[model samples]
Target: MSDKKALNFTNWDTTFDNGTSEDGSRNCVYMSESLDYKWVATSCVEKINFL
Candidate 1:
């Protein structure tokens, strides 16, 4: 029911991409060029360092 989605496979929870559930605690998602421009999810308060 939320916009939390993972465009790429993650070592963390997979529900973000499956849309099966919404993780209110971690509401941040971004695309990673290293992973072929796939999406990654994390906490909004955390800094995303990708190159």
Candidate 2:
């Protein structure tokens, strides 16, 4: 549930959605490539973004 910046990359920025997802099933946050890499909430468990 943490992010890259939390690991010491201060200059980096994370673009999150307006808020958590309305769908109760989607509780995880991920970078959306279709939305220009903005952080979007989803239930996906296969893809993992790393620093």
Candidate 3:
């Protein structure tokens, strides 16, 4: 009989420039599936900071 294995998963968060005249923020999330990977990008203008 052949052996089977479960898929491995990972999560990541990062910030990037939005490349616009107005100040923009970008939030990204990534997931890996075997040799392939997928990502989601969100763009916003509002800023939130906590101190």
Candidate 4:
């Protein structure tokens, strides 16, 4: 019989907030332990503007 390793899974809690501004500027925030929160924000904005 062949031996193999099972994949491991992680449980994470996340928080998101709408960063809408009064001037009609749209923004978003995401928080997770697996990644840098700031990076997520920057990446999201970049994607939105790119579209």
Q: Which pairs of residues have clashing backbones in candidate 3?
A: none
Query: What C-alpha lDDT, on a 0 to 100 scale, does residue 7 get in candidate 2?
Result: 52
Ten-residue segment with the worst summed lDDT in candidate 3?
12-21
Clashes of 1: 0
Ranking by TM-score: 1, 2, 4, 3
Query: Which ranking of candidates, highest lDDT first?
Result: 1, 2, 4, 3
Worst 10 residues of 4 by lDDT: 42-51
The C-alpha stretches of model 4 lying farther than 4 A from their native spots are 1-26, 36-39, 42-51
Candidate 2 clashing pairs?
none
lDDT, candidate 4, 1-51, per-residue tens: 246667664433334333444444444434444554233332334334321
Runs in model 1 with CA error above 4 Å? Answer: 1-24, 49-51
Candidate 4 positional error at 31, Å = 0.9
Best by lDDT: 1
If both were scored by TM-score, which would come out higher, candidate 1 or candidate 2?
1
Of candidates 4 and 2, the better by lDDT: 2
Q: Model 3, range 18-41, lDDT digits (tens) per residue?
A: 244343545533343432444434
Tens digit per residue, CA lDDT, model 1, 1-51: 277785664554333453323344556777766666666675676676756
Q: Clashes in each model (backbone N, CA, C under 3 Å)?
A: 0, 0, 0, 0
Tens-digit lDDT string for candidate 2 (2-33)? 56454542321245443444543666666666
> In lDDT terms, how accurate is model 2?
0.54
The list of candidate 2 runs beyond 4 A from truth reads 1-23, 44-51
